[model samples]
Target: MEKLQAAQLKKVLKPIHLWAIAVGLVISGEYFGWNFGWAVSGTIGFLIATLVITLMYITFIFSYTELTTSIPHAGGAFAYAYRAMGPFGGLIAGYATLVDFLFATPAIGFALGSYLHFLYPQIAVIPAALVFNVAFILLNISGVKESATFSVFITLLAVGELLLFMGIVGPHFKLDNFMTSPMPFGWAGVFAALPFAVWFYLAIEGVAMVAEEVKDPKRNIPRGYISSLATLIFLALGVMILTGGITDWRKLSAIDYPLPEAISIVLGKSSALTQIFASIGLFGLIASFHGTILAGSRQVYAMARSGYLPGKLAQVNTRFKTPHWALVFGGLISFAALFTGTTSQIIILSVLGAIVMYMMSMISLFILRVKEPRMERPFTAPFYPVFPAIALLISSICLVAIVYYNVQISLIFFAGLAIVTLIFVILGKHKVQILIHTD
Candidate 1:
């Protein structure tokens, strides 16, 4: 892992600013649509699942916070692993993360399509997907400020609608709906929910990607990741439970847009408030996907600057100080996926990629702690061995769940990548020096 002469990161994003971007991306499609599974799993089971995932998320956040602030380079997970392990580890993590972001763009694009359908019933799904791809591309190319501003507005609107809708619908709640099923499919249902559940918990790592741009990253990165993730999990728990209490689980399971339907049922479908909620959900998803494009591209730039990726990918525009090639490469991948199978399938693949990356990240944390005890880390993981160990265990469990859910192709793809990365490592190590670049 040789770091060359790379462009310095412009400190354009503060820690809270990045958190706002992440929160914006998260609140859109995820909140409105996640309850569909809860309908089948029952309220108590769903609540437990949410709690487990949220805790695991915070734990992972702490581990990443230590890595990001210590390194504060462009390659989020990729560079972290490379610095701790070797070029081979870096390549594997980098490629896995690249695949995760690539598929994630389209998955979010497809969500944009679904939300557009809800808004304009007559709009074609294919067209909506393409529109999302192009719109996000333009937004990302424009600059970070433009993208974040739009995202903040749409995200806040969506959050407001979600909170208001939940408040209005809560009074009509029934407790029996939550306790009706006791993990109905037992272990199978838990496995079934794993992919989607993991998907729901994705993107909390966005704060780490902008570490270089953050003001006082040593303090802010850790704070933003835990605080923002905690906030998101709280909202998710409330939405899941309230949606369960207010509506029949049976009906919600049957409907495609469960949250919107629950809102319509409580407020009446013809009401203007109902329409506003639906509209916010629609545009909010587009805005969220837009923010993802912003975060994902910078990671590519980071990897490229570290010399794990093609040199061209690391190039930033002189005027914009933006990773131009990284943005285009990411957009092209998302555009390609737009024409493929269902968005849900793309989301599954993306989740699989993320799971693998998280597993590698956990491993890297242990290795770094053992190998570099004297290295400076502005933020440290709480409880040392315990937090990372728990995070690793949870990640492994989620991997099993993903494989159990029949995403074997994604697993196989990741395995093949590992083999190739090992080959690259052996080939590169003898021929090149492992350089660690810092000012």
Candidate 2:
């Protein structure tokens, strides 16, 4: 009775909600963050990087969907890895995922504020970011159904805005402007740009974090993942290519508000249309902001429920049936992160965490195939070994390249991983029985 009475999430999500969550979680990359790739790789080099990363996501989402449908848990990669590789594997995946979404939250928050500042110069950036973070945290605590509904509405607005942006910016594109210094540092820059490319679809896997809440997840998860990825691939490539050709591209490469700034260059900064478009741009950031908080809290809730963290963190709100405490805890971490670094630095850390988690997830899928061949899978990955192998290979190469190019960031990531591992081991967490119910 006690176990049954414990707070649980309501299964109120449909395919549309999942699609909204999936696309909304990653749409911000189309808005910004990815332009940083141009700074390192130039237009042509970053395009190559983006294409390669796009392939990885295509293979990864298809391969990842099987694990998601088979093990429909809110822990996402953590649950998959834990089930495949045991407690230590679970901890590593959980920690990587926490780093991915938690860090991503503040990065998106920064963009939200930056967009607001771009709209109203006197509003200030950091304070606006802090407020957006707090607002979304509270919104997530309300209820999953209500949150998903809001996600659908906001996601639609964001998607429409991107479409409109493309339409407005397309005519102004100059092929010559885009081709200048197309490969400034040769092929090495493509490798350096991988993290920014990954940003284009970083958290699409976050849909897995809400698998438990999906209605008929076996059928809907694959649909949502496939559709959302298709949409993002179109939007990312179109936005990047279009935005690049409008100006020096170099000028837009380093800024947080690149898309709007690009628009201002085309439409005149003082144009009312430019101002309205900039205001609309906030929807994309808000969508991802909400999605990350929703996914981040679930990862925390799943870990806490399994005794990897304090049990209190798993407590769901009685009336809302949401992981209220987990939401609050994750929000606090994101707030700390807000002061940590620039949007580019935060994006690098988040992408690193995401890549590590992706590698773990692929390994888990392969292991599960061998370990539980008879386990019922409502959705099996197409092309099996080949798809997953490609994803792993590309991800491994990207990981190596990122570390080689950004030695300091790599060290920070590894050091953080090491510290967390040491603490988990010291706490004897590996020996603790972890029971995360997939159903």
Compared with the true structure, all predictions reach lDDT values of 0.71, 0.92
Summarize candidate 1's per-residue lDDT along 1-439 as a digit string, tens digits: 4447777767777655766776765664355445545644555665666667776777887877788788776578887787777777777777777777777778777766666676678987777877777777777767666666676677677667667767887898888866677477665666566666665667667666667777777777776676667667767777777777775676776333666677788888888877777776665566567767877898888776766668898887786677878888888888887886566567667767777788888899899998998889888888888888888888888778767665565665668686767766665742554565433
lDDT of 2 by residue, 65-170 (tens): 9999999998999989988999889988998899899999999999999999988889999999999988988899899999999999999999999999999999
The Cα error of candidate 2 at residue 51, in Å, is 0.4
Candidates in order: C-alpha RMSD to true structure: 2.5, 1.6
> Model 1: C-alpha RMSD to truth?
2.5
* Each candidate's clash count: 0, 0
TM-score of each: 0.91, 0.98
